[model samples]
Target: MDELSVKASSLGDNLSAPDGSDLPEPRRDFHDEQYLSQCSLKSRDLLLLTCPNLGLQVCWFLLMSSGTPYLESLDISKSITSLVWLTGPIFGAFAQPIFGILSDESRHPWGKRKPFILCGASCVATCFLALACAEDITDGPTNAPTADSDSTKHWYTQVFAIACVGVITFAMQAYQSGVRALIVDNCPPQQQAAASAWSMRWNVAGNLVLSTVGFLDAKRTFFRPEGNAKFKILAVVTTACIVVTVGLVSYYVADSSQNPRGKSRQPLTKLCWSMLCPAELSKHWNQLPPVSHRVCTIQLFAWVAWFPVLYYTSTFAYETVLPYNFARELHEKGQLDIRLIEHAELHRSSSMLYFAFATFATSLLLHMIEHAMPAFDHTQPRIWFFSQCSLGFCLLLTFFARTGATATIIISVMGASWAVAMWIPFALISAEISQPSPSKLGGKTGWILGLHNMAMSLPQIVSAILCAVILGALRWLNIGDGIAWIFRLASIAVFYSAYLINKL
Candidate 1:
């Protein structure tokens, strides 16, 4: 037996022994069952568990909402922008699971999760800061937009920027997986649902903040910075928030060393090798519980439809809707207006803000529904199916949208799927794997979660590959000013995901 089981067995024997008979209800008071099941956390602990998510979400939103737009402003080709954006998902595909396995086996004095969390947060902040000033920092010949230089120097700056983004993306994955594992470690099995609910709530809060900042920044109301300068300012704000929030979480949360339930860890080298070689990890994947199997399948299909919406929405809006409107208004004058580009930026930011609000509102409604009818559980496969259908419908609606407002409204409706997509898979998976039972071998929690995360990573890789194809083999289908068909494909994938959820 493992140490946890041994201790529990010893406690049971002592409590029921003759000398202890005088003690009233020793079994009730001293049983390990009660101790493990009743490990309820206070509100303060929940807040600590959630703060890092706030910072991380802020950074994530800023990057996702702004990154490609910033690149496009520099007149970078769409293909190159997608390639730059691909860096994060590609790196994260390896990084999250690897970090997860490493943290699982970690015996660091400061704790397994905390060290990575701190390191990741610091790297994220530093790299994000670099991105904020990428224009200023990349002094190669490419930066001089109006000046002439060898194509090599210009490409050098672009490559450097992409590299920085890749590093930041990799670091954020480490921070994300670490925080997720820490929450799993701290919460007992029974309370995990509540923990996940609160987690979703906090995530919405972060989105709200992110959207508000994005809206304000786009209007240039929050800062005087023009062009990419505004992103630089936002980057500063993002860095400070991550540093302070992650620092507080690190200082306040106790180390995992204080809790021992599992067996000796596998050698780090073995885990590393397994991650590097699919054959080594395939057994673990095949052996996953039925519920995990279901959740992973759902997640994989869900993201295939979701990521394109996220990565390409702003670009689509600019090319298909906003520019046309701008052209229509300027047609009478028979002159092209440069100011339309600025207006398009504002419109995209507004759309982002609306999207965030939709998520926030959907989360609140879902919470109320879950509370009023506990039978309608948040992680129910049918609920996911319905949510996916609704999201797919919204994406399909975008195909016919003739104006920015119509597109924005359609995306706002998508917030429902977005919230469920973010919340359900993790909650369902956590509930299945995070039982209080002692580990028969070392806890497989890390690798388990890592495998599920790979589902997310896979879609990104697929999307990147498809992005290249859409630009090449499918160029003729760019019927909606070059990016419309991608939405239709995403819609089909989402409906298929919903269908898969029904099977699950």
Candidate 2:
């Protein structure tokens, strides 16, 4: 009898108490039924969770809006400078995927996302400083012409600045991935779209902040912002925002530490091997459902359509338009130098801020429509389709822009599309994977989202490569207003992207 009883207890999870009854196991908080059933977080918690993105968005806009012009300010050839632009998309290609894998599998006590967030924020601050100080440290000319560079002179300063930008892009991509995964982790699957919508709102808010700030003259204020001084001002302002927002979110928010339901971790070496190997990672890709594939495909083309616009809008304003505005007078006076370039870039930068405002305004309108009429939810695909097509039409209009102001107006209107693009794809992905409880993709949410990000980055890579080849040819032929034609050409891709969205 005793031997039989011992076998029974051993076979079962229950122990043989004095009464020979099983004791119930302790309930886990992470897997609490009540928590899983909740659709969304409270407004306060949601705000805290999304706060970091505000600063991050501002950092990204500052870079995309000004980086090209700033690089040109150093007198670097656009062909060679296009190579610097290439680093952003190159690192972007892998940075999110690798960071996503790491964040998903991380067993850190401080939290999976927190460590990455902290590390990325610190690196971003340093990288911005490095970019700001590039000319000073490498002894490169602080002010190069906006219109063109003298190819004969070579400066190591431009090289160092380029390196800083590359490092910063990787860090930025990782930081953004962490924040995104953290939001996904904290919310229930049902709230994925809402969560993504909130994220987009924060992004728009950041742009509004930039639009407000762009009007002020840094030199007129306390900073005396000119040349590298503007960059320093940018770096310092970003640092303050990061410290406040990232610090708050990282401390106040929680994240999944490897597994939410249980403590299990894949071997670290194996995870690293899977990340580095295309074949190994392909296994994870297969786990994603059809919706993930469709959404990611759409994102791929959508970004391809947008990269040139993002990178070259300011360039279009500065290169194609600014030349007509100021270049003729300055060239005639034999005083075509740094001041002319600075003023032109500053003017274009102010105009780019209007692009931000457009994006912000559009996002606000969308939120209102969605809130005021829940029935409009059915029209998302249609809304996305038309919005994207509008950008395509705007790109075609770029071919006819005779002045910087006209080009600025075209870029600003494109932001309405930008608003939709930012929200829908991510919200769709989140909604898809969440509907089936833990999801078929399961613990691989981070990996799946990483792949989605890869979709966006890869096209940018292709776009950058194309830009380099085309700009080299243009510069070689001594052609101005070439970017206008490039924009008209790119509109084809955007229209096709609109078709893809309609198919969705």
CA error at residue 153 for candidate 1, angstroms: 6.5
Stretches of candidate 1 off by over 4 Å are 1-31, 74-76, 140-156, 220-225, 258-262, 323-334, 338-343, 376-379, 437-442, 473-478
Please report the TM-score between candidate 2 and the true structure. 0.83
Which lDDT values do the candidates have, in the order given?
0.71, 0.71
Clashing pairs in 2: none
**Residue range 317-349, candidate 1, lDDT tens digits:** 666555444565577788756677667777777
Per-residue C-alpha lDDT of model 2 across residues 1-504, encoded as one tens digit per residue: 111111121112212223434334422233333434432345556667778888888788778766765788888776676777777777777778878878877777777777888899889988888888876676536375443343322356767887888888889877888887777666555556677778898898877775556546522443443556765776777778888999887656545454534547777677768766889767766667676787777777778768888877777877754554357667899878876576666656666678888888888898788888766646777888898889889988876787667877888898778889888888878766554333445655667788888888889988778766776687578676667767777887788878888887
Query: How accurate locally is residue 490 in candidate 2, as Cα lDDT from 0 to 100?
Result: 80
Clashing pairs in 1: 142-154
Instruction: Give the Cα error of residue 247 in candidate 2, in Å.
Output: 1.0
**Alpha-carbon deviation at 481 in model 1, angstroms:** 4.2
